[model samples]
Target chain A: MRSDLVDHVMTVFGAVVRGLVYSMLALPAILVVASSFTSSDTMSFPPTGLSLRWYKKAFDSEVFMSALWTSTYVAVLVSIIALAIGFAAAFAINRFSFRGKMFLQGLAFSPLIVPAVVLGIGLLQLFAWLDLTQTIYPLLLGHLVLAIPYVVRTVLASLSLHDQMLEQAAMNLRATPVQVIRRITLPLILPGLLSAAIFAFVTSFGNVTVSAFLTYGGNVTLPVQIFTYVNTSYDPVAAAVSTLMIIVTLAVILTVERLIGAERLA
Target chain B: MKQSVLNRRNVSVAVLLAPMVLLLTCFLVVPVLGLLRSSFLPGSEFLAGNGFSLTQYVRFFSDSYYSSVLMETFVDGLIVSVVCLVIGFPTGYSLARLSPSARRWRTMIVILPLTLSLVVVVFGWLIILGRNGLINSLFVRIGVFSSPKTLLFNRVAVTVVLVQQFLPFMILSVMSVVTQIHPVLEQAAANLRANRFATFRRVIVPLAMPGVLVGFNLVFVLSISAFITPRLIGGARVAMLGSLIYERIMSELNWPSGAAMAFVLFVSGLGFTAALNALAGSHLITKGRGNAL
Candidate 1:
């Protein structure tokens, strides 16, 4: 009986601690989202009145709009590039028993392990050396390096779970390897590909550390622009922009959760 | 026929591997190599000059200010790792043991912070932890203080933001590993008349050690190399390796010095990750569990 009471107490205590931690983690973004609706000019919790004035300010500002456009085009390009290369790499690693297979996998995932600051400065130096710093190519290429690891990771996860027997049977039926992959392996891994694309897009769009160094001319990515702006400004317009970003992020994440299942994200 | 088949397979594999290998090599590997190379070259002021020299590295290592920045980074990393482990382990354990629906909601709450941009999240925290921000406002309203206190731009604010940013990684790492451990082992512990605490310490912990090590390494490496949090939140008060590298390269235009500092941070981060791989092997517990962010 005494032990049963102890067990009950422990369960309740664990739940409370979990609840507190979760709330603390979610609070910052929640506050940002909440304050975006503030009727007042300044940020405050339980904001005075509901208004979208700051969001209008965000939309009307040319700087924010241009940054958003830059972020979008770059992220789209990154997703496509990362998906194409990462898929081929992942497919080879999964389907073949080649020498240096492990090495290839290591190289593919190496960018994830390297610190962003290191990559940022390294890429900046490399681009400047090649006289490519002024172009958008460095930003595109840098983001590709960052985003490809996710592509490889997600694609690999799906490939492992797919049936190899189907591909083998297709080969035995005199189907060329291309035909087999196009018909069999590709169809099986399509969900993985879509999720990987979305994952890559979000990763590129949200990246700031590397983008901070690579933003040339007026082609600042949204996150970097936001970072620069927030450092100097205290107005609620920043909060409004952040709130909109949070909504979009939540939407993408929810789609991943609904379409592919959130477990796949992990 | 066998030789033809072998050649065909080789050709196909090579074709499939080319694009990713080329991209990673040209963009990622070469740039990192360039940084390392630049650090060794002689430089007049900010420009990296021809000829091999270790002057940049020597300058960084010999300067007390720079050395302190490196020390401060590691110390903050160590503290953050310990705190995350203490808090994240229990939450992860509870998450692993929870019913499916409950776990789903809980995991979302945990992951929401991670999915948002770090800059935006830090902004939110700025309001909450700033001088006239939520905490101070509430405290004063309740007569806890006479006036609002300056809470932002300090080590405490930086640490708070770092811990919040990285806690999800720790919890998810532990949760992934915890889920893999067979529940029957815990049942057996219960069958042996062990209480919950004893069972956790004796049975669960031994099995969860791999996850703990991986989580510690990840949190430590990430926190140490973090750039934005230390810059915006730490302000000018705290000097971390990341912020120093940024200032050197961006503001000071000292590529060799910046590269040297970056390389130092890289080597330390690499050391921690290598240690993690040795202890837990290449299969990070968090792999495919979602993005590590």
Candidate 2:
């Protein structure tokens, strides 16, 4: 009986510690969202009366608005391009046993292993040498490289879990290869594809290191803009913008959870 | 007919691979090669001169300031990874022990910060750790302190923020492996007269080492290469190798020196990954994991 009590106490202690750790994990985002509603000019927590003035201010600013637009379009384009390439590579790797298959798979995932700072500087140097620094191509291409690995990983996971017998059955019914893929394969993997696109979108949207190097005049991304802003100033506008970013990210994550179940994502 | 079919299959495979191959080669391979080549050139002659030299490397090695930055970067990486492991192990273990529905909700909360941008998250830290911010005000109100302390722009703040940022990776890595360990083994250990702590230490921990190592290497690499967190939180008072490299390339326009330092950072990360793998060889506990790094 004494030992049972000891075990119970130990269990309670473990639960309390775990609770605190999880709270620490969630504390930063919570603080940022809370401070975004501060009524005062200075940023503070437990916020001196609630207000949305900072959100209005963030929307009113041309710099934040333009940067948001840039980030959105760039992320959309990157997600589409990454999906096309990642789908093809993942399909080929999953379906066919070609020579250099391992090489292709390794090369496809290699960007994840390389440090982002190196990739940033390398692209900056390459663009400067090619005299392409003035254009938006560097930012697009840099994010594309950073975003593709995630797309491949997600798509590959989706494809691997897919059943091949359905495709075989479709072929047995005199369906053409294209018809088999369109009618049988695509629908089965649509959840994975959507999730892969979301992964690509988030990776591209949240990027700062590579974008910092590649963003040319008048083309800064939202994250980079916020980074630069916070470096020099302490204000609630950053909090408002950060809250919006969190809301967008949370929405995407919820959509993914609805589509694929967040547990599977882990 | 068979030969023709084989040729068509080959052609289609090539077609599927062509775009990705082209993109990676043009943007990733060529640029990295150029960066490596330029690291051998002198800083002043980055654009004009083609001749190779070891001046940049010598400068990095011989200078105490640069070398200390590199050492500090590795030390910080070590501290973050260790702290992450200590905290993440229990959280992941408990998470693995949860019911399916409960685990799902808990995991979403755990990974919520990961979905948000690092800049946004760091801004949160800035608010909390700034003078007259959350902790300071609370402490002063309770008479724990006389005034708001200079909490931001220090190593402790940087370490705390980094641990917060990268803890999810370690948790997920541990949780994935822990879930795979059969419950029956724990039962069997208990049946053999072992206590809960004994079962955890002998059965669970050894089984979970592969995941622990993967999380360790991942957190270490990420923490060392981290740029924005250290720059924002550490400010000018603390310098990491990543910030130093950023300053050289972006601020000073010394491409060669920056490129060399970047290469050093990359190699050190790779070296540590290899060393960890070597240390955890193909034993029974690590056998089925298959090159997790």
Candidate 3:
């Protein structure tokens, strides 16, 4: 009984510690927004006054909004292409016995092992060779390389988790091959696909290295825009923009969870 | 019927593999090959003054500055990778054993930080670890310290942020391996009068070692190439290999020399990976760790 009591107290203490750590981790993100209200000339902590002027400046800006749109467009495209091709390859590897099975996986996974900076440099060189420098194509290609491994991993896990017996049963019932895929496999793996796509979007949306080489004067993404702007100037406007990004992201995640039931993902 | 079904499966596999093959060759293979060739090319007419030379390598190895930066980056990489595994294994195991419903919620917390971009995540850390940041503020609140703490612009800050950022990869990698170890195995061990720690130390750790190695390799490779994290968080104080390459490409515009630096980064990644693969293939780990593994 004494030992049981000790274990119980330890469990409670562990829970409290975990909560405290998580809260501390979360607080810095909140401070990014809260500090925007500071009326001081420098980025002083513990502000004395509050205002929405910085938020206003962030919204009224032309550069920030256009970059936001450009990122939005590219992220969506990356997600779609990455899922279609990555999921298909994952399905093939997991579902079939073939020569070069391990080789295919190794090939697909190597890009991720290549660091983003080196891969960025490589892409810049290749694109320059092809006379495609300073364009969205190279950036998109670089992101696609990074994204493929993730899509393959997630979709392959989901695909393998599903029982093969179902596919056999579907075929035994005279369902067409396409029908079996559409009805059984797609539904089973939809959550993984969604999660992978969402991740690809977020990753590309905030990309730096690959896009840094690829961005023309008029084609900035949110992160590149923020980095360049923040380099020369430190102000509440950058803070406001960051806060807005955080808010939008949280909203999307919660909305997606509510719509599809977040449990499906795990 | 068997023949027809086999034929159909073959066709399906080919169809599925097509796009991935093309994109991979274009983006992955071509570029790596390009990197190799570029690294070996002759220096510019200016640097070499008219001929091919081994001078790029002579410069890289001969310079203490470049060699030390490369070495520090690898050391930091090893530390970050090992730390993530140390923390991630238990967390991953807990996630795997939990009731499936509870796992969904837990996974959310695990993956949430990962979904944020590297820049955004580092930006968040900058605020907390910056001068007059949250840690210092809290320390003063409780009378732990009088002045702001020094966290950023140091080796410690780089490791902390890198560990936090890359931890999810470690967890996910280990989780994949751990989830494969059936609970029945553990239940059987319990039936034989083995204690929980004994079973885990002997049985679980051995089975989990491969995943740990994979996670280690992945994290080490990633950290070796990490630039933005070290740059932003460690400030100008860091001398990582990635920063060295950045200096050449961004500052000096010496593309050939930068290519040499990039090759060192590539070779370093490959060397670590080869060692990890050899470790995995040898199976000598089990013999050495017979007490725990």
Candidate 4:
């Protein structure tokens, strides 16, 4: 009877804990989405009445639109570059044993260990010294450094999981190494590659620390723009822009869930 | 003939490794080295000279204000990490015990916040924690407070947002280890007449320590270096290392001072990471011995 009471209490305790964790993670985003539809101009709770005026304002803002564009293209560019570089590195590290191979692996993974603020300041100073601060190249390269580590780590995880027997069997059938790789190896690791690309895109899109320093003139990314905008203004328009971000992030995450189970991310 | 084949293999390997090596060298390694070099330059000659000096370092160490910022960053990180552990461990334990489908739904809820832009997340918190925001309104409506209070732009608001920001990481880290712990361990403890609490205290807590340690370290490092949340939520009053570094560079144009602060932040982060590594290593050694016993 005592054990039964303990179990009952534990069960109730667990449920309450679960509910709290769930609400803490999900409620803020939901509130932002709800408040974006506020008819009132001021930032009020329970959001007054439901309307989309803030959404219209967010859409009409040129600064927000351009920042969104910059963020998109930069994210796309970062994914492609990081994927290409990480794939080659992963292939070498997995398939061949060579001198400095461990060093190569460490270098690829180093960015993950370094603080993003340090990287941001370093890149900012480096570009300023070179007079390249005005151009978008620093942003591209800074994000590339941040994104490449994820790509390499993901691709390496994928490569380790894949069966090498298929490549060996293909080679025994008189297939060239390149042919074996293209036909057997590539297809097997394609999911990892796709996962890596998606991870890179998400990281690059969500980045602000590194991008904050690299942004110059009118070249702010969406997060950086929103950050600066929020500092000055505290209205529903910020919520509107944030709601849009939440939507896009949700779409990407849902797609990733469909492609690869979310468990692998943990 | 053997040498020629070896040469060809080496060439292919070099080709495969070149791009990654070059990119890291040019962008990651060189830039950091450059920043370090600049930090050593005299603050007066930071923009122009190549001469090495430790004036920035001296000033940083000598000044209480700067050291206080650094100390606050670590203290905040420690507080948030502890808070996340107290709250997040149950969530992870729950996740590990759930059915696969239920875990999937819960995992999505956890991961969605991580994938969303930090700016968006902080903005949401701003609205909810502001003067006339949701929590205040609810409190006032319930007569808990006579009026709406300015809850945002303070340490509590900053800490709350950071806890939310990093809780998913802690939960996932703990979950990864907790799921590895077999159910029979707990069952055996129960069979030995240990109650559920005893089973948890003796069987579960020891096993979950490694994950908890890892999650704690990650949360510490991330929260320490986090710029946006503290800046947006903490406002101008609460100064952190990341924001101080930003001010020195962007607003102050004091590259040497900023670079020095960056290196200090990196070193402190490295210090915490090393401490965690030591903790994890000792835990493994003890666990191995216990198994043998």
Candidate 5:
């Protein structure tokens, strides 16, 4: 009876500690979102009366607006291109036993292991030598390299979980290879494809290190802009922008959760 | 007929892989090679004129300032990794123990922070840790402190934010492996007259070492290479190797020196990853019953 009480107390202690740790994980974002609604000019938590002035300020600024636009289009393009390349590589890897398959797989996932700072400097130097540093190509290409690994990983997971016997059964029904892929394989892996695309999108969208190096004049990404802004300024406007970013990320996450479930993505 | 079929298969495979290979070669491989080449060049050349020299690398090694930065970067990585493991092990164990539906929502909470941009997350930290921010104001109001302390721009703040940022990766890694450990083993251990702690220490921890090592490797690599968090929170006061490299390349316009340092960082990261893998192979494989990894 005494040992049972001790076990119960231990369980309660463990639960309380776990609860605090999870709260600590969540506290920063919650603080940022709460502080964004401050009525005063200075950013504060337990905000000094709620207001939307900061959000209005963020929206009104041309720098913030243009950066948002740049980030959106760059992310969209990167996601599409990454999906195309990742899908092909993932499919080839999953479906066939080719020579250098291990090497190819390693190369595909190599970007994840390399530090973003290293990749950023390398691309910057390469673009400077090629005299293409002035254009938006560096930013697009840098983000593409960073984003592809996520797409490949997600698509590969999706493809591996897929069964090939269905494709075989489709072939036995007199379907052409293309028809088999289109009719059976594509629909089944659509969730994975969508998940991969979303992963690509968020990676490209949230990138700061590579974008910092590659973003040329008039082409700064939202995250880079916010990074620069917060370094110099301590205003609620930055908080407001951060809140919006959080909302967008949360929205994307929710959509994926609804479509495929977050557990599967993990 | 067999020859034609074999040729056709090879051709299709090559065609499918072509675009990805081309992209990686052009952007990833060529640029990295270019960086490696420049790292061997004289600092005065600015990546255009090429005279091969190890001056940049020698400068990095000889300069106490640069070497300390490198050391500090590794130390910071180690600190973050250790803390993440300590906190994440329990969270991940509990997560693994949950029902499927319960686990899903808890997993969502963990995943949410990861999806937010690093800049946004750091900004959130700034609000909380800034002078007159949440902690200070609350403490002062409740008479815990006399005034608002300088909470931002320090090693502690940087470490705290990094732990928050990377904890999810560690948790997810641990949970993935923990979920794979059969419940029957725990039952068997209990049936053999083992207590809960004994079961956890002997059965669960050994089984979970592979995941723990993987998580440690990942968090260490990421924390050392981290740029924005250290730069924002630690500022110039506690600059890591990443912030130093950024300053050299961006502010000073010293490509060769920056490239050399970047190369050093890459090699060290790779070295640590390999060392950990070897450690897992030699130790875990011999002792553990199955290859958990």
Candidate 6:
């Protein structure tokens, strides 16, 4: 009898642990993804019925489209800007040892440790002062602040691995500084540059913390759109939108991985 | 063969850094300066000073309500990070032990969470944790409980969401640090007749503390400033620092107070991280010197 009781107790405790872990990992489907499958007039769990209506509804929604475009455009620009700035800094930091190298390194990597919301507040206050918060430019600029760190680290890793001896040999052969750069350094680090650009793209593309407080109506990113939607209503439409986000993001990540072999670049 | 080219190439370093210098100043340095200056701007009250004023600090630190909220925020942060470490450490160790190519693919999967927006995750949790959600339905079907438990807009929900969301990052950071520690350290301990528990506590734990510190700092900083997850999961019941700052600025229309709060948040986050980084750097420096012999 005691053994039976012990077995029962063990089974119950085991289930609890299983339930919690399962919910932790699998709840995304229950909460976000599965809800997209409701065949009802309102959001229901186990989705009362399965249909594609809400997905269609989300697609027809104008606000969702606007926010999607906003995020795409902002992410594209932020990636480009972060790549340029980080490329410059990485080139300088790796190619030559300077007096302020440590300080500059810290300055570049500072945002990696700072919280996004804090960064957002500071950027919002600064941009508001400059009367620029309402526009998409501030949104891009705010993302650039955060995205540059990724670019710097990625490019720096590649640059350090690059063969300085080859560049020196090129110079020995009478190649100009420009020629050496074009033939040697840039080609070697292009993979890193590409990886950095992808990282920047994804970071900016998915960011909501810095983008949230900084975003105004015209500057509403996709995440902001999802936020407002979830806040105001409860429905499978959110699930549909989330499904959309997941698909697009998965595609982008895979493409980036293929281009640079995500592991090597990271 | 070309010494003259070396001189010009050295000069080219300045050209490479110039644009970056300008960007860093505008995007980073200048904003911090602006935030600091705005923190001291005059309030409409009697107490106003240029040098130092506790108007904002005093208000937040004095009130028991905000103080409780602050304590809760830190506790939640600690819990989230520690929970991540517990799950992430094993996963990280496993990933580290994998062959290089396999490790790469595993890392890609682990980091997929990071590459997407947090908004999706929060929204995802809501459906799953809701009263009529999967867990509840499963419980009812199995006769575990007649009524579905309320998991939404609660502390448990908040912590769960944060942990699931940030687990990948904790794993990545811990894996990076653990990858550096030779597995032979643990093996040696095991060979010396130490049980797994002893080996873990004495050997694994000490080596992994650096990553633990880093992961803890990041998760803490992130948890402190997080507005949306708690907003979505915990609702208005939980007053975290992130929402407080938002309310102070947007609702109260107090920009100076908002700036002060933001500065405090910024400094505290940076300050603690700097302290941790200093410890890690000094450790590395000492190890470097020891290796020179």
- Decreasing lDDT order of the candidates: 2, 4, 5, 1, 6, 3
Task: Write the residue-wise lDDT of candidate 4 on A1-266 in tens digits.
Answer: 89878877887887898899999999889988989999997988888988888989989999999999999999999999999998999989988998888888889989977888889988887888889889999999988988888899888888998788888899999999989888898889887788889889989998988899989767999999999999898888889988888888888777777776777766
- Please name the candidate that would achieve the greatest TM-score relative to the true structure: 5
Interface RMSD of each: 1.7, 1.9, 3.3, 1.7, 1.8, 5.1
B1-293 per-residue lDDT for model 3 (tens digits):
99999898898899999998999899878976776566665673222334456678888899998888888999999899988887777666766777877777666666556565566666767767767666777788889988877788899889988887787777777777888899998998878866666567777888887888888888898788887777778778877888677767766767667777888888878887898789776765656566544
Instruction: Kindly indicate the candidate among 1 and 6 with the higher DockQ.
Output: 1
lDDT of 5 by residue, A4-53 (tens): 66567757866886897788878888989998898998977668998899
DockQ of each: 0.65, 0.67, 0.43, 0.71, 0.69, 0.43
Kindly indicate the candidate among 1 and 4 with the higher lDDT: 4
Cα lDDT for residue B259, candidate 5: 90
TM-score against native, each model: 0.94, 0.95, 0.86, 0.95, 0.96, 0.87
**lDDT of model 4, residue A166:** 82
Model 2: per-residue Cα lDDT over B159-224, one tens digit each: 999999999889988999999999999999879877777677778888898899889988999899
Q: How close is candidate 2 to the true structure, as a TM-score?
A: 0.95
**lDDT for position B222 in model 1:** 84
The CA-based lDDT of model 5 is what?
0.87
The root-mean-square deviation over C-alpha atoms between each candidate and the true structure, in angstroms, is: 4.4, 2.8, 3.9, 2.1, 2.2, 5.2
Candidate 2 is graded, for docking, as: medium
Two-way DockQ contest, 2 vs 5, winner: 5
**Lowest-lDDT window of 10 residues in candidate 1 chain A?**
A257-266
Model 1, stretches more than 4 Å misplaced?
A: A1-13, B44-48, B273-293
- The C-alpha lDDT values of all candidates are 0.85, 0.88, 0.75, 0.88, 0.87, 0.77
Model 2 regions lying over 4 Å from their true place: A1-13, B282-293
Candidate 4 CAPRI classification by DockQ:
medium
